[model samples]
Target: MSKRSESFLRSRELAVAFKASIPVMMGYSVLGFSFGLLAVSQGLTWQWPVLMSLLIYAGALQFLAVGMLRAKAGLFDLFVAAIFVNIRQAFYGLSLLRPFRKTGSLKPYLIFALTDETYALMTTRKIDPRLKRRWVLFYLAALNQSYWVGGTVAGVLFGSTVHFDTRGIDFALTALFVVLAMEQYKAKRKLLPFLLGAGASLIAMVSVPADRMLITAIVLALLGMFALRKRIEDV
Candidate 1:
């Protein structure tokens, strides 16, 4: 192809990626804003939120880090917690192996930027094959992170100045998860995985302390899914 044609195609891919990422943009902005506001409210400075959003970029883990930081948690503890919280991303990465194989130097950044929303968009949306797949994926990941970081910065600025009730702001993250889960269910039309997940969570909640419930639930769900993998795949 001619240079002009290549440039135009690249731009088209970027535009498509940005458009597809708009839903995540909306969700991340609100959720990141909530993280920033909550972090500051809990006595963390604006810098922590901005830095974590830019570097860590894991929504749930970042929120958890706020309390860990406040409690003066050690590096080993933080590392363990981060692993447990983001273990699901390891599973997310498995699904994207083929798509990311040709990403070259972009592979590391792509992996780093694979938040739940980005993964959902990539796996669920049908992209035009004519577009450069790697570039499209790269743009989608980059654009989503930019939205999150921008929201975190805005939230910190807002929280630093204003002082209203931030009581229910954290619900934004949970709401986003619900929407994503609903979208996944609609797309896959599968019930077994959802049922197993809910059952594991309930079991974990009853068996474990509140502080350990999330990790326990995730472990239980993964084990259940693995044990029933043959049935799930058949369905």
Candidate 2:
């Protein structure tokens, strides 16, 4: 293809990816801003949120980081926090191994950018036949990160000026999750995963502190899926 035509096609593919990633843009912007707000409220500089979103980009973990940073958490605390907050990502990568095979040199970054929102969008959103799958996936991940970074920077720039109650700001994370869960359910119509997660969480909470609950729940949920592998795969 001619250079002009190649550029045009690439732009079109990027547009489609951006369009598909709109929901994530909305979710991440708000949540990332909230993270920025919370991080600054903890007496850290606005740079904290901007850096966190740009580098870390994981919503829940960033939220957790705010508290951890405030409390002066040690290396072990940080390590455990990361594992608990990101454990479910293990399953996400496993499921995407086949779909992401074609992403080639971009595969490493794609996997690294596999936030929960991005994962849901890639797994559930239909791709246009004419657009290259690898490019679309790459752009979706890139655009989502951009939105988060924009939001965080905006928050950091504006967080100091605003001085109102952030008493319930953390709820925004839960709300974002509810939205993602609804989208996934609509896409797959499967309840087994949700049921397993809830069951394992309930069981885990009974045995561990709230901080350790998610990691334990993920472990139990994985084991449960393994025991019911046939049923899970068939579904």
lDDT of 1 by residue, 63-124 (tens): 87776676776787678789877888898689899999998999999999998789998898
Clashes of each: 0, 0
lDDT of each: 0.87, 0.83
Residue 120 C-alpha lDDT in model 2: 88
In model 2, which regions exceed 4 Å deviation?
174-235
lDDT of 2 at 151: 83
TM-score of each model, in listed order: 0.75, 0.75
What TM-score would you give candidate 1 relative to the actual structure?
Answer: 0.75
Question: Candidate 2 on 5-60: residue-level lDDT in tens?
Answer: 98888999899998899988887887677778877877888777887787787878
